[model samples]
Target chain A: MTAILLISSALFCAGVYGLLSQRHAVGVLIAIELMINAANLLLVGFGWRTGGAFGQSFALFTMAIAVAEVVVGLALILLMYRSRGDVQVDQATELAQ
Target chain B: MNPLISAALVALGLPAALALLLAVVPKLRRTGKPAALLSILGSLLALSAAGWLAATWLHDPKQVLDLTTSWLPQSGKSMSQVGVHLDGISVSMLLVVAIVASCVQLFSLGYLSDEPAPALGRYYAYQSLFLFSMNLLVLAPDLMQLFLGWELVGATSYLLIGFWFTRPAAGKAALKAFVVTKFADSGLILALITLVAWTGSFSWNATLPAGGAEWLALFLFIAVMGKSAQFPLHIWLPDAMQGPTPVSALLHAATMVAAGVYLIVRADPIFAAAPHVRLFMTDLGAITALFAALIAMVQTDIKKVLAYSTCSQLGYMISGLGAGSLMGGYFHLTTHAFFKALLFLAAGAVIHAVHSNELSDMGGLWRKLKFTTVAFVIGSLSLAGLPGLSGFYSKDLILEAVHESGNPLALGLLMATAGLTAFYMTRTVVKAFFGKPSHAAEHAHGPGPSMTIPLLILLVPAIGLGWLAGPMSKLYGRSYAFHLDTIGMVTIALGLGGIALGWLIYGMGLLQALPRAFAPIARIANGSTVDDLWALSYSKLGMGLARAIAWFDRYIIDGLMNFLGWLFMWSGQRVRTLQTGNVQDYLYAVFGAAALIALWGGWR
Candidate 1:
């Protein structure tokens, strides 16, 4: 159990760093999926220890959200690539000007 | 119900109707002679009506005819009424106003007939309006009606005084007259408010409330002083001579100036209730009479001399009213009307002939204008209170009243003022008529019959009105016999002495001018410095105050408003920068806030 916890913590930290620093649009989307799965693993682990089904249910809910997020994110990247011919995460910040 | 009532109404209504018709009818408004003729006809109708009312009132002094109709319908309170109260005083006032107005209009027909200006229609219209307002002023039953009439007369006088608006002096003089009278008019407003608040009624029949009765009397007296040209307020009348000559005769000398005296006589009960107020009025009257008389002596302009004399005579009437003799005051007001109007009209005729107002430019006109000379001499005699003249009868009564009131100071000042009146008038006559021909007088000619007729008609009243003093005194519900009282003797001697002194000086050239010892005192009394001070206070001081207020409003009030506006604008601009329209930046901010919150929660 301790080993699993250590691995999941490392995964969450790596996912947060990638999500913030990634320059490519698809790379950022993959980092968000990684972060969501890491959260789901933590939820399942805690649920098994606490002898409750609540954590497993929440993990299920998070997994479904992760799938929906990837779908919308890929669509955004497709739109950006079609418009600019290069889907860079920095180029998506038309909001900043 | 009463014939006098209808006569009074006609006296009040005819002039108003004609003025309205002339003003509203564009066709009638375009013509000059027709307007003058209509005005004269209306004034004559008013004269006949006023004459009938006077004759009726004279037959029975106690008869008071009140005619009223509901003016404003109110739900809770009893409604106010449009009304006229025809009594002895009102009848007498109406008669004097009508007679004088009739003569002035007749004279104006000639004065304006030859005038090259095309605006004579407006001139006659204003004259008619003035007559209407004055008649309304005399006949009004309530304080409200009196005030309305008072203000109407003031406005009409303003219009007439500025009739020749092309001249700068005429315009300035009109403004000065209006402003000064308006300042005094506020006193009437205050008096009305006080009367209404205290007595709960605006009727003249309402006895004044007891608590602030003296203050109310003072307010009314202040209004009278302003209208009558008492001491401090006499400054306007001399300047108001810039108006047309007939206007000066009708309004300034005959009616409007006397309106103040008429008010005191009408509101006698109120003044009687406040002895201190009466004393104050007496002092003001005495000071104005003496001061104006002295000023009249120094004036070089013929009309200015008459203007000051009118002021002095009005002072006599006011002082008489203050001294508790309604008969004396009203009688003087009546007689003064005739002589003063006569004097002004005669002066107008002389000016007409010589085409000048300065005494320096008028001399030896007696030979050229024989009828005007006779009229002027008779008017002068009446004014100087020579025995058996109208002014003697009235001036003696005023002196006796002041003496009987036991105000030694007022009596002395008034008697001395009487002497001064004679001196100045005699000096004016000598300088203008008896001396060698001046450059202007060299080309002098007699005025036409239209002018001469009014003068001749007024001369009869100026001479014979003194004998009517016995009968006229009875109009005030008192039987006064003609007798030379001690004060009467003193005024008589002083009047003769004044004329003798003037004859020795100007007629015979016995002295160069008023004694050299009088130079400094004359300089002070001549009103140059006082006039400057008056001009400065109203113009310079008033402007300074207004500018200071404007500065405060701009810097202090507007500064606060602008500062708040600027603060809102600056903060809005700063807050707008946060809305950078960047989706990534917004997401970053949300996540950073969420992370900070999570960290704080874990620590807790």
Candidate 2:
């Protein structure tokens, strides 16, 4: 259980760093999915160790939310690629000072 | 309905209705003849009503025909009445006002007939309005209603004076007259306020205590001085001759100037309650009488001479009232109205034919304009107060009143002023009627019967109204008398001596060289310096104050507002950079804020 928690924390830290510093749209979406999967791994590990049906049901709910997130992220990336011929976040700064 | 009320309705309502019709109806306004006829008929109806009221008053001396109805019936706190009081004094004033008004309207048929239709219509409209206001003033029972009539007359005077608005001089003169009188009107307004506050009433019958009454009397006297053209306010009258001749006859000579005397007589109890105010009025009247007569002696314009004489004669009436003889003052007002109106209308005819107002341009017109010359001579003789004329009876009475008051200084000044009146009028007549044919007067001709008939009618009063003095005095509650005493003889001698002197100088050319001797005195009497002083104080000083106020508003008041606006713009520009609409930057800001909040929550 301790090892699983360490792995999930590291994934969440990487996701946050990517959200703030990544210049590519696809990289940002992959990082977001990584954070969601890390949360799902933590929930499933806790459920198996505690031996409760409630924790397992909550882990299932997290998996469903992750699925919806990936679906919306891929659609946005496809639109960006079609409009600009490249899915880069830096090129979308039309409101720059 | 009372007959008195019916008289008042005719006197007040007829002219107002006619004025409204002439103003609103395009058909009436398109023709001069119909307007003149309407004005004449309205005045004639009013005159008959006044005649009927006078007859009724004669039958019963104690009969006070008063009609009052609430003016502001909806007022929960106070109610004022708008009505008429038909007493002996009011009846007499009504009679004089109507007679003069009708005569002037009749004469306007010839005087203004040559003008275009619209201008003639406008003149008759204003004339009707003036008649209504004057009659209302005479008949008003309360001070408030009297003030309404007062202000209306002043407005009508302005409109009539500036009737020929194409002339810049006429417009300026109108404005000057209005401003000067309005300044005095402020004093009247203040007096009304004080009186109302002290007694809670605006009726002339409200008896005030001694101290309050004195202040009110002083304020009222100041207004009277302005309206009557006394002393410093006398400057506007000579310039007011820029109006048509009929207007001069109606407003300046016959009725409007007399209003001041009428007011003081109406408010005699207030003035009597303060002896000092009466004495002050006497001194002011005497000084104005002397100075205005002096000015009249030197004027070159024909109308200016008559205008100054009007002022001087009004001074005599005021002095009579001031010296404690209301009977004598109002008596002179009645007689003066006839002769002065006659003089002005006759002069209008001469000026119309000669096409000039200059005495120098009016020589040798007597033969060509025979009827007008005869009428003018009757007016001039009466004005000089010759024995047996109407002016003789009234002027003699005023002098006797001053003498009886025991104020030797006022008496002497008034007597000398009377002599000066004779001198100046005789000089004017001699220069404008009896000399060799002037270039301007060479083609002068007689006016039509529309003008000559009014002069003929006024001649009866000018020559014979003095006999009515005894009966009129009795009506005013004074004893009737027709005897001539020492003062009367001296005044007559002085008057005759003045006419003889003027005859020697101008009529006989005995004093053709006298102008050289009188040059130094003439310079002061011409009054250019007095005119300059008044213009400087009233106009230039007012302009200077206005400019200073404008400067302060522009700099100090505007500067603070401008600085606040600049500061707002500067701070707004600095805050605008934070509104960068990039989605990535907003998301980064939100995530950074969330991280900081989580760290703070853990520490707590």
Candidate 3:
């Protein structure tokens, strides 16, 4: 369980760093996906330790949501690139100060 | 409702309704004939109602009618009321107003005939409003209602005096009259506030605090001096002649100027309590009388001559009242109303005929306007206090009152004023009617029946109203008899002598340069020095204080407001820096705030 947690924490930290530093819209989506996978890993580990399928079921639901979110996120990035010839998220800030 | 109340209501309401109709209805206002007809009809109805009220009073002169309802009620305290108070004074004033107002409206039809339809309609509307305001003042039961009516009449006077607002002189005259009277009205307002604060009532009969009566009387007389056009404040009346002649007739003769005397008579109890103020009123009246008559003697404009005469004649009435003779003052007011209105209307006809107000433009007018000449001569004779005319009777009574008051100086000044009144009037008549025809006078035309009929109607009162003095005296609950006493005989002599002296100077042309001897006096009388003095004080004192107040308002007061605005703007500028338009920065700050909140909650 401790090894599973350590790997999950490392993945979540990498996702946070990528989300803050990335300028491209696709890079941000990839970083978000990494964070969700890290949470799923922790959930599965906890379920196995408790000797039940409750946590594993939750992880399955989470994976399905993540798949739907990634599809929507990629579509938005494609529309932005078509409109502006670029998908750099920072340059797409129309509502910024 | 009582029948008398119903009559009073009609007398007051008809004109108010007509004024409203003529003012608000675009169609009626645009059409001259309908608006004039409506105004005349309203005035006649009010006249009949006033006649009815007078008849009721004559039937029982001793019976007083006071009907009031609570207007501003306060529990266990005195409240203001709205209603009528009909006594000898109010009823008499009502009849005079009704008669004069009706005559003036009728006269206006011809006097203002040359005006455009809309202008004529507007004129009649103002006339109706004036009638309503004067009647309201006559019928007021308390000082509060009286003040309301007083202010209304003053406003109407302003409107009427500036009726020809296209004329710059008329506009300025109206402003001058309004400001002078309003300045005096502050005294009245102060008296009213003090009266109410101390006595808790606005009734004339309210018991005043110690020494309050003198102050109130002094204040009231100050207002009278302004409204009645006494001495220094009288500068407006002559200038107010820039209005249409009929408006000048109504203002000078019966309504606006007479309201002051009526106020004095109505508030008799207060004046009676303040003997010192009464004496002051007598001396002031005497001075105004002689002063205005002196000025009248030198005026080149016919209307200005009559305007100054009005101020002089008003002085006589005021002097009479100040001498504690109600019958003398009020009776003179009644008689003066008829003859002065007659004289003004006659002058209006002459002006209408020659198309000029200057005396130089009018000579041998009698040959052209025969009936008007006759009317003018009679009015002039009455104004000069010829024997057996209405003016003689009233003027004698005032002189007698002054004589009885033991003010030898006032009596002497009044006597001199009577002679001057005769002299100036004779000079006017001789210059305007008897000399060779000027170019305008040669081509002059006579007034139509609309103008002549009012003159003919007023002629009766101007000639014979004096015979009713005994009955009028009875109305005041006093006994009076018409007799040519020593004072009466002396006044008649002075009047005739003045006429003779005027004939010698202007009529016979024996002493043409005699007037030149008095030119210095005339120059002083005609000078604008008094007016300039008032203006100077206003600029130096009133404007200076206003400037200080304005500076304080702009700097000190506005500085605090601007400081508050700056504080809010500075704080807003600091807070706006948080919005950098970067999603990453906003997210970081939000997450940091959430973590801090979570840690604090965990510690708690």
Q: Which lDDT values do the candidates have, in the order given?
A: 0.86, 0.87, 0.89
**lDDT, model 1:** 0.86
Tens-digit lDDT track of model 3 for B53-141: 88888778897888888878888554788888888778878988998889989999988888899999999899999998888899999
For candidate 2, the docking band is acceptable
Q: Per-residue lDDT tens digits of candidate 1, residues B1-604?
A: 6777777888888899989987887677668888888899999999999888878877887887788877656566644567788888888889999999999999988876666434888888888899889988988887777888899999998999998899999999999898889889899889888887777766755776574668888998888878898978878889999998999999999999888888877777778888999888887889889998988888999999999999899989889888998988999998999999999999999998888899999989999988888889889989999989999999888888888899999999999999988998899998888889898898998888889888888888888988887668777768888898788888899999999999998899887656566667778998666678888997789989999889989988998899899999999899878866645456577767888999999999
**Per-residue lDDT of model 2, residues A1-97, tens digit only:** 8999999888887887887678888788887888887888888888888887877799889888888988888898898799878877867765754
Worst 10 residues of 2 chain A by lDDT: A88-97
Per-candidate DockQ values are 0.32, 0.36, 0.28
- Which of the CAPRI classes, incorrect, acceptable, medium or high, describes model 1? acceptable
In TM-score terms, which candidate is top? 1
Model 1: runs farther than 4 Å from truth? Answer: A1-97, B72-75, B116-118, B513-515, B580-585, B596-604
Show the lowest summed lDDT stretch of 10 residues, model 2 chain B: B72-81
Q: What share of the true interface contacts does each candidate keep?
A: 0.37, 0.43, 0.33
DockQ of predicted candidate 2: 0.36
TM-scores of the candidates, chain A only = 0.86, 0.78, 0.92
Against the true structure, candidate 1 reaches a TM-score of 0.91
Task: Kindly give the stretch of ten consecutive residues in candidate 3 chain B with the minimal lDDT sum.
Answer: B579-588
